[model samples]
Target: MSSTGIEIERAAGFVKNETPQIVTSRFDVEDSHTLVGYLATGGYEGIRKALTQTPAEVHGEIRDATVLGRGGAGFPAGVKWGFMPPDVFPRYLVVNGDESEPGTYKDRLLMELDPHQLIEGCLIASYAVGLSQCFLYVRGEMALAQERIATALNEAYAAGYVGRNILGTDFSLDIILHWGAGAYVVGEETALIESLEGNRGMPRLKPPYFPAAIGLYGKPTIVNNVETLANLPWIANNGAEEYRKIGTETSPGTRMVAVSGHVKRPGVYEIINGTTTFRQLLFDEEYCGGMLEGRTLKAFVPGGGSAPWFLPDQLDLPFEASEVGPAGSMLGSGAIMVMDDTTDIPKAAHSLTRFYAHESCGKCVPCREGGTWLERILGRIIDGHGTTRDLAMLLEVGETICPGDFPHASSERLGLDAQRFPYQMTTICFVGPSAFAPIHSALTLFPEEFAERVRDVTDEELAASAVGAVPVELKGVAAQ
Candidate 1:
């Protein structure tokens, strides 16, 4: 057995059968993308079964299952559906296929492999909410996924399963496929809605413009991620109780995690939420098969690029949101990026800071200014022109630009009732915090790397640099 209690011999011989294949069941199957092959695997059965029951029944079953949103936030999916206003006409449903987060590619694979499943999930969601038409906002770079889904949509419409009395029932719906212009901020639901309406992809304020109350052409709307809707069929067919047994009591069902960065085998793997630890995920041959070139683990991004990275000590923790949240991080987008000892932490932080700076929509002051300053400061550090004061400046600027509040669900099972701080959101959207997460975490987790780049500055130099309040205790800043 390896250090993590996983049998090395067993992991070495691991096959696809070792793990529960929920979302990636079709990965090994031939012709899985075609309509005929999808039907052979009992596709569209969920919507067919859903049409027999009332919309409320479908919603209740999902709520009982406790399937949280797979897109970064970890909010409960059923609760979001319930927020739609009652007796409201022209309600809309949108599938957020705009996956622009770095190191996260699970949604793109799901769409390419099982477009039929997504279409069926979309149909069930539309029925539950009385939405006559639904739109799928796919990432523009994913041309292959777009082609496959477009083909599947044509097949479903021809078979009378998509448009006009689906499966001979009164519930008729239409599904439209739209491509995005590759803006990271457009991944935000309201911003995606704004872009869908032929406008710039900038986020709208809350309260009056909440997507549940007012969205997409000023109507009630529910914007769900692609992975969230894909799970509906399994819940609809197998019942909520059965689905709950797959994962932990708090976060049930399997989720696809995309593993990237310095690893021997970097790809996507589906694991039951909270059941697998970061240690097993990294060392076990079934997953990443340990680090590349036999190097020791140094640090890793626990979630997506927007999430704070975790050190080796936190490796025993589960990959679920409930476990990672209280530990001062989140399971954002379920993308784990592993880094080895040879990596330069300061250089990496600068690279990610550049991404957020370029992706900022420039809608609000905090995000725009904060992102630009972060990029420039990190750039200076990488070029060996930074001072020790730059470290405090990074954290201070991050706090000023965005609140470091953890992402939580509206429900108790998924979030905490106790408030961390008085609700003080400075920006229009989460882009500010998203930009700051890596920069702040990099400094906190790998201080030695930052300290190495910091030059020895005289006391007079510190005052001249406008860092008069810089701590006098710091090594060279006080005096010789």
Candidate 2:
């Protein structure tokens, strides 16, 4: 049977995250992050283990711990690491430092505060994946992060953590830095790896397969997210079981949740695995401050931008992968976008669809063309172009491109008819379907918004720009 998802089987005393625990590497908002500071906090301990232990031992430790990628696709980190061939001569460890997921900000906080935590994580990842060379592919907009990491890398090198035959075990590595021009899809592991190889940063097909088998110039490579790598030192220093002691059986270790929208404290907070509850966040942690005084909770994007959004009634479900997937969503990047009663769910989803439309890499026709077409259709509908049948039509078309399709191909589909297709793709059910949920739910939940639209829809005069007549947001922010 397939792995459904992860849930908290038997978690004891709940750990409410009132503030960020600040582990691994700590970045001070206004203070200095010197080399001494990182070393002082027990940094580079993972690297020390890697230098002393065998690759098999390191692999077993990671596999036993159940650490998944912190990016959208929560693939097993150890499994990805084990796929690398021992005698591949040379391999690569590519770190995805791009934090373009709309609602996510955990990695940014980590990079801003403790750049070396990531560097040290990359070193351990490199050692485990059997690569002496690695690269941190950051987004172009993160100039300050680039500077901070650059300085940290130099400091690491000066201390002999990186470079030739050092750490006294003959294992040496150097991590290079690269930047993306800009694109949300670049966060995908394959796309980032492609970008590092100096391409357009579009994702490639699997099973020609995962990067751990063959990546970066047609050699074996293991691409991991910055946050995933950040936990390496902690995992090594404390044992695998210690890390496992936190999260659920399937999803172990703490997660830095980035809370945004309709919240009093709209920032990143570190919560122990399976310890924090959704209600605790709103009522206890006071991040949401209890839904804008009078308004009830509308919905929330459980993950970051690409994940599904849920209604207020479903708040009691566990936020782990198991609980989330069974409930028709995924714990994407732990970027919880809580929407209050005032927010229009459809309009919010449309706003997200627009982002996906702009950021979609044109590798496959479905994600590229389908996303664009959906945005246009949604744009017209949101701009008072609805006539009642649009909702069913939207859901239908979502299924068409979800498994994806080229002129004559698709992403991970099985056959012409969806019946032959996997249950996962056929329903158009997970996150992509969720992109439509907010809008669909809103049309029913907040009929007043649409009634106002049907009665008072009007176009203003602003046609004297280079981009022609474009749609504007509900709050009047034009879609340019």
Candidate 3:
């Protein structure tokens, strides 16, 4: 028996016979980040193989593999490559390494430990897509990661692995390392492009400004996540069929998962994509090794902080998008955060809302104003001056961001049936919805916690207690 009272079913095939170490294969090697060490471990072999094949052939292999973007959106990587306008010159590849999503640190580990692998992956992607130039946008806070990649870029260029006729072939490419200013909003593709062009890092509306069609410098571009690009070298080297054998049919190959919070061992683990369940990840000794001592599982964020929280009942679901998405959350960014029974639900929700509130970019009105509003209300409830009306207002404010049936776990208190995820949103990007995710999950999953924290406080008391007075829009909901 584990700490959560769940049986440790080690005999079951939840644990694969041989775990596939795709991107993380070189992590344990001491000098894996160095060009010499990376070369010894079959680093640039994928790009070498890629250069031998035609661009279309290389693209075909990746497309056949169906490598889903390891970034939050989980879109197909090869398909994204094909989105470039035919015969368009100066096509660009922007690598998203701005990993600011809370509870998501897998991309940072990849950049810091095996930068050469990421470079090789970048080489493969640029070659396959006929991209003239590549930009690696790393988060500013990751000084070690930026240093490692910059040094690796210099070594790669000197070794002829980058810049003009790579490995003595007709193919030529240039990879540039660009640092981000540690803004969470730039994690969005277009916003990253905006920052790269020396503008404010705020997302551009879709349709008129899809990155693949009209991206950086008003030309065709492909923006891929660090982990998503990192997988290309492996797929190019092993072939698509070999990669498919590792994980399930839809989500082929392994994914790096960063498990944290109240777990015995909380670190990055590359697991077989669809085969690994939350229970296997959280409780399996090879993964997180169950929760901390004396901590029974209460709830966990299935993806990053933005994903809707999952109760203990959903633990058996696999870490696949198909499985987790229908269950009212997503396996976004491959980050799993565990919370124990002792966690204060209202206070915890307040913390997440506070992050989204602070990081709003002030581009979208709903996200800028509504996110801050949601945070203040949660804060007020946590400080013990909430009313029953305040709970209703949380859902109402959430509805303004994500309209019509907010994605939530089944709640007996609210007499609500479980709603599925990918909630309908009124905002431009997911930032507004991200702010509401924790509030909806907390109120729906554990209404009693909020109820216990609330008193029949007068309107003046509520106003006095809150950091920001409740907005007029929310004030209307509270009155009702």
Candidate 4:
């Protein structure tokens, strides 16, 4: 069991196949964070083998393996590396360690328990991409992870694994450890680059500011998630074909899923990608060990807090991006938050909206103003001061942020339908859509819960007033 009372279990025959533990392989070994301990478990061997081949060869290997980014976007790491404009000198590699998504703790575990593995992965990536320097940007709240990585860096530097002609090869690189001030928006690649350059951590607009083309300090930059790069050592040691055999064809190898909420055993589990289903993850004894006692599963946040919620109907869906994306959610950040029947839907939606509102950097007007507006409306409903108009306003505000048909669970109770996943966004980043996700999901999935808390207004009154037009009753409620 972990410190949070969540039991971390290894992947077993829940899928009738033995899942290979890649990143979390050394997590159980004692002193695994140390160079000596890592060496005993064959650490740094990947870099040693990587040095034997040319940079292009190592790059091709990763591209062939199809290692998707584990942070959230699920972009292939090699394809991202290939975007670096050729002949560009002084290219930098930024490892994103800002694991700030709610219920997402897999990167922190990887950094804290096996720092050496991350370093080795960085070394391999640096060599393959010809990066001049590397930056490991960890979240500010992860002090233990920062300490472990810092210690590992010092050990690596002293032992010649990092810096100056590593392993007698022409490659020389430096790994710098930098931590943020706990801003959630910095998890975005361009936003993370802004923070690294001593800015306010706001996301940069694409087209003119894609990180691969024009990034930190106006040069080429490749920002990969910690988990994405951590898979490098294994891909380097074992052939890509061998790695491909573990999971499905589209999503090969294993992924670390951090499960939380009402489940009995709710910790990180390395399950073979695309093979496991929500039913196996939540009910299988090796995974979440089923919902708490007699409480049946109500709903779950499929991919971190930002994703649209999923109901019991999605239990049998495979935990794959292709399947989940078409099912009205994503396997984003590999974070699964379970909620049982006893959960309060309105309050839950209010809690998540409040987080996005508080974390908004105020860069985009839709996210800055509209997100807070949505939060206030949800809170008012939760506090028993909301009117029927508030429900219409919630969807209206969400539509402004995510224009067009928004994705939501089936609302058969009210005869209201929803579109599929991947809603259109007006903001520069997903933060605006994230703030509205819970509202859309909760209202669609469990409309009765919200209706019970709100004061029903006459249809004539609702039709007479326009959305967002604060009436006398809501004036004081909105002010509060």
For candidate 4, the C-alpha RMSD (Å) to the true structure equals 3.9
Q: How do the predictions measure up, each by TM-score?
A: 0.89, 0.81, 0.91, 0.92
Tell me which residue pairs clash in candidate 2.
Answer: 5-322, 6-322, 27-113, 346-439, 406-409
The local lDDT score (0 to 100) that residue 415 gets in candidate 4 is 58
TM-score of 1: 0.89
Residue 466, model 2: Cα distance from true site in angstroms: 34
Ranking of all predicted structures according to lDDT, beginning with the best and ending with the worst: 4, 3, 1, 2
Per residue, candidate 3 scores C-alpha lDDT tens digits across 1-480 of 768574433331122224878888887778989998998999899998888899899999999999899889999999988888898888999999999888898888899989999998888888888899999999999999999999999999999999988899988888999998878999989899999999999898877535888999999999999999899899999999999998899888999888777777777788898988889888988877888777799899989999999887787888788877778888889887788988888888888899999999998888998999999988888887778878888888888888887776554445666677788887777788999999989888887888788776567756755867675446879988
Q: How much is the lDDT of residue 126 in candidate 3?
A: 87
How many backbone collisions does model 3 have? Answer: 0
* lDDT (Cα, tens digit) per residue for candidate 2, span 287-389: 4445544557767777777665566655776657766665555677888888877776557868988887777676666566667776777777778876344
User: After superposing candidate 3, which stretches have Cα over 4 Å from the reference?
Assistant: 1-18, 411-416, 457-480
Point out where model 1 deviates above 4 Å: 1-17, 208-210, 403-424, 459-480
- Candidate 4 total steric clashes: 0
lDDT of 1 by residue, 394-465 (tens): 878888876555332122322323222112458887787777777876776667789988987767776755
Evaluate all candidate structures by whole-model CA lDDT and list the values in order.
0.81, 0.67, 0.86, 0.88
Best by TM-score: 4
Worst ten in a row by lDDT for model 1: 414-423
Total clashes for model 1: 0
TM-score, candidate number 2: 0.81
Task: Tell me the spans in candidate 4 whose CA falls farther than 4 Å from its real position.
Answer: 1-18, 410-418, 458-480
Worst 10 residues of 4 by lDDT: 9-18
- Worst 10-residue lDDT window for candidate 2 reads 406-415
